[model samples]
Target: MPGKTKRSGDLATALAALAGLSYLPPVAAAPLTFASPPAEIAKAVLDDEPGTVAVGIWRNQQGRFALQRNPVGSVGEVVEDDSAHAQPLFEIGSISKVFTGLLLAQAVERGDLSLDDTLGKLLEAKATLKPETAAITLRQLVTHSACLPREPQDFPGYGTPNPFSRHDRWKIYAGLSGMTLEHAPPCGAAYSNLGMGLVGQLLSDHYAKPWDVLVRENITGPLGMRDTMQYLGRQASRLATGYQHEALQGPWDFDALSGAGALRSTAPDLLLLARALMAGRAGPLGPAAERALTPLGYFRGDEIGYAILIRGPAGHRTYHHDGLTGGYRTLLAFAPDTQEAVAILASNSHASPVKVLTGITASRYPIAPATQMAPAPAALAEYGGVYQADKDTSFTFVAQDGKLYRRSTGTGFRALSPGGPDTFVDADAGARYVFSREAGEIVRVDYYLGDSGFGGFSSFSGVAGLRTKEAAPPVAVVSLDTQLDYAGHYRARRIIRTDLDLDVRAENGQLGVRAGNWFRRPVFPVAGKPDRFAYENGRSQLQFERDAAGHVAGVVLYENGVIRLRRLP
Candidate 1:
């Protein structure tokens, strides 16, 4: 009853705040200035999206400037009214990883932990861990090189919109007990939530305190970030409603993985955090912040520093992190050389605040324009192949007409002009693809699409099986009747308080499936396997099982984990 009451209270508070905002004056744009023009940046970001709310802050030697704009509309509401300021609470998502990284630095500074300390050394007394995981070091976790999967394999309630709501400590430890590394530590940089969460958990165990408490005592409190916290707790009244597209969405909840993306803060608080990072001084944790910004290696189109990503060249480097949860999107970035920092927080998940944030940063410190280059035909041919980020997502590079082009499902081929050696740029989408070579052989490609959703880039390794045109096979179409047989509603085997359902539909003589809001796509029958379906360009597969009567009984969905769902009726 207490939990229910809290949920109701939170909703009431959020709705009440939204209602009160209706009567408030329209948020005015700050006056323009040459150093950091708020009006110009706001026009570029908010002009297209009329009802979006944005809070922007810039700090430099000239001074600090802040702006807030709440367009006239509530998410999913017909009425055109909403309000926000620089101090309202918002979920910072993965930016919380930076705070966790800072905690690791602090621990090392205090002689309580070492960057090279093994997972076995820290958690051996708490629970048994696999040798591979035990061998992973704290540095690897912070740098995202531990080769841990993005999420726990046995993560419960995987199909739910709030995937991490039910992922508590018990589930985390249980998931780790059966865990095995896909690759050894330092196996290139892969963004991982599990690795960062473990860092937070280790810190909690060492201090014998909760993650939030440790953060507040060591980081937020010292930085004067009074409005920042892990849980809204009694401050729910200040929390803003989150929106995905035009629909209202639930806020993310965290348990063991709170360290990954659980912290919530206001724009002012984040600006304070950014200032501390740029100034590289805030007392006890100041030195740790400096250490956290030190570059470890290159990853995802940027230098993989501790928990932060560093971009641009020397003297114009930008240290930053961006985050996305169920319904919130946030970005915090700063150029230390110019002492200019920007924090953009939005309630709308689809908002592209990063563009405006980067625009402002560029105004202060311009990035070099991308130039075109021409590589030898042999060099271009060697990079031609299919690269996959997951089962359902892949990019195929084709050499045609003496030029390199990229093609993918549902999209036409686009020219990939050379930007540099082993690097290509997509002029249309403003994306850059950099190839990684080992012994002069292409091994992986990193795609940088700019800071918009979650992280700005994804690393896709070249698929050896699809290296040649002849190696790939064609897909077979399923019979109409057979496709219809698989159409039904199914329920996830492991359900929490929230009911999880999967919908398998046959449309236009094709079979498609969706689980909650994760993704929806047509599943084609594999070349020779009639019962097996490939989705996301063969990045994932689904298998249908039959009953004694030869009727469809259940479905097995395979991606990062295997999920079994039974027919509802």
Candidate 2:
């Protein structure tokens, strides 16, 4: 009788608490003079958003200025009041890849490794890498051209709410042993955490030490980045608690993949590194650091010269990297030509620090805006369709009022103005979209962000990947008895280090799924498909599997890849 109308009391209470509570306002803090360009930018960011604790550092030929506000919160406590020099530890995330990239350059200078060295030569004995993987060079890995998936196949099955917590060295090697290249080496740039993780692992093995040791002895140590490290260790008290939508989130830990996004640092330390890079000082790794800043080639339509992203032409360019973890967001960017740099570290996961960094950079270096024009109605209609890059990522173009709008699950819709035939520009964000046609039919789309559309852009091809807006038939009402039968506990088929269990329950005549204690959401039955259910706000689907006796035995999750979960007795 409770099947169709009952709700979980705990879930209801949690949701209520989440909705009722408001984020704490920024505490009264330091007064920053808006005299300098960086100071003005910092004030604008703080004034625009309340309850945001941010630290920004600007260094130019004139001098250095740092700005801060409020106190950094961790878990539920405010650890330290923010100051221009407050050394509150913040997770650097993917920026760790930039450090690893510098390490590779250092290795090359020491004659310890070469960018041309093959993966087979470095990791042959540790894991049974695919033949194609063996042929991938270190340069390809650092530039994200090794064609590796963003994460390993079993990454989801790891089960921990914090995915990287238990993905240790052995598991990493195991994943590599079974990996099959989806595309050949030097396949147009696809950002890959796996590839960067491999760079750290190979460097550690070659040095006969741990990755943390290698980073400290070479990159951070030489640059005088005392607070930067893979682990907080004794400095845990200085670490800020990360927050997501006002909910407390745990800090991320790394095993083998620590090289991907494992370092915690302070704004001052990042500024120190940036200053050294801009000065091109002669230190132990200084020459190598300069080399790492060189542009390797075009990636996703941007320059990929080393481990970090490079933008603009040769003489005028910005070399930078951005990082995101559960509760932290960071931006480290600098322009070499103007001797200016911006480093922003924030405690809120949803915060967009890059926008602030961009503001600072744009003020220093002006970018020409793209000219906009009204496109014909037929042109707008031709590009209107749903295009998907992967199972979990997609874009939809719609024609409304003679203008083409682009939509995604993450960001809603933004109207695009035509810059040229089959080319559109988003003036506010400085993004450009160019459509490719074959025999007068729209076949592909390319998207470029920043740089006023001077570099390469990521391409999405194939007409078969398009989705239509046509309405579907009404879903048949599933029997209450059948819905009850689907209730059970399920676990991933692959044995993982952490728990990956799915609990299904029939509540209020609908099916609800909870993965461990992290994700709990309702699922709806698909029209004309009795065994399929949609979840994750329709970004993912689950297909129930049956045993020989016609009883539910398991489920297949369809997202970026297929994951099998067996029904547990």
Candidate 3:
């Protein structure tokens, strides 16, 4: 269904965040300075993208700087806001979850709720609950480990602009009553909108009030976030028009799931929120800020401090969260130690303003899309091999017609544009990939999804997704008969089922372990370690023991301790 669209770069922008992205290496990781007027940085964010963009940066003594890049009359240009002041409303989608989480923390501070309280305890009067549902605690819900699914059961029109238009309070409670969890509580930090939505609902139910109203009274009201609310009302005109794939989109509404992603605000107002978060418990945010930001669980491989994703290390810890809805994108990140923060709001749904913000916050210059050029086929051909990662995943690249393409899990044949000699970027944006070589031979590829998690999806920025050539799957297979001395079954009773049974089949020094088991994988020969093989692409290695007769007898794996598996007939 294609039509003459008014939106900018609809197809390219739509794929920006969800597509295959790689990471770039700046000169070094440091604070970005603003030599050119902040406007230049804002333009950098808007460069190579569509629509209006605005950001607010704050420092301890520096106060706050607001910059806006207004769309150039729906044309192919972007202009700085001549208004001199940033005041435009945009939907802060999942970011609303942090506010919901804040409410829970506030309730905890006020003795209105306990983190350990179960779902059944709060919603028993409103809805029936299964055993697992009843066991869900407030902590699990806020941390996104409640084991709840992404959406409520029997959700109507789940993928439309108005995903929760029909999901009112009644339906939410009804869905909760019979809800089932795939696993027990604290399910290892998988993002769950339904779980956070339930937190808002359960909190509102306890107080017998609306969830958004609670947000106003407890958070926005106290913090003077006047422009932040679910409904724009009088400020409706100020609300920027949101878009998806170059077509205009209507406002998104949430009845019971308002806590999940149902709030709109301006860059200044969000900057206020980030500032409050930086102040910690002693500040206007009260103990709730500290409570919400306390390390709780894992989120996208890092730490999830309640609703916020906590990154960096001690003294440099940063709290951040991003929101994306119908046609708007929002992000808020602040570091208490550096007393610095960044807030971004964009009207274009296709492009990611957050990645730009990521660059701005990381360096003094604006991070732009790498200008890609056609690379020589000889250069591309060297990258046409398989790379294995630690988490049972692999990346296979193919060079065809002077272009390099990737064959990965979900995405099929995404082209990688040359950003540098050994670096490539996704044409759709939101990703960058870098290649490394040792001794003039390509060794590993390091990449990131996008600068932001929009995550709990494919791309989360910051963390490196490393793939080593040494961990690559078998390329030149040799017949099993060639390694007859090592070709046999091995069993480990000490380890988990993962390595309980091993069928070592190899050729050309590559050993395929767990032949008949589910996680069957090839182990490459480890350098300087004779009779030893590696798996997880070299993250782990094991030694093959031979009996006195020189016949392969067993395999010994070294982890935290030795795990010996006897050779089986």
Better of 1 and 2 by TM-score: 2
**Per-model TM against the reference:** 0.65, 0.69, 0.62
| Global lDDT of each candidate | 0.63, 0.64, 0.63
Candidate 3 per-residue lDDT over residues 370-449, each given as its tens digit: 66676778877777776654232356666765767654432224456776668776534335566778788776675543
CA shift at 179, candidate 1, in angstroms?
Answer: 1.7
Candidate 3 accuracy as TM-score? 0.62
Q: Write the per-residue lDDT of candidate 2 for residues 340-365, one digit (tens) a residue.
A: 66676766554555555344333433
Task: Spell out the clash pairs found in candidate 1.
Answer: 391-539, 391-540, 392-536, 392-539
Task: Please provide, for model 1 over 120-187, each residue's C-alpha lDDT reduced to its tens digit, 9 standing for 90 to 100.
Answer: 88877666888887888999988888888766775543224566677777677777777878777776
The candidate 2 region of ten consecutive residues with least summed lDDT is 19-28
Model 3 score (lDDT): 0.63
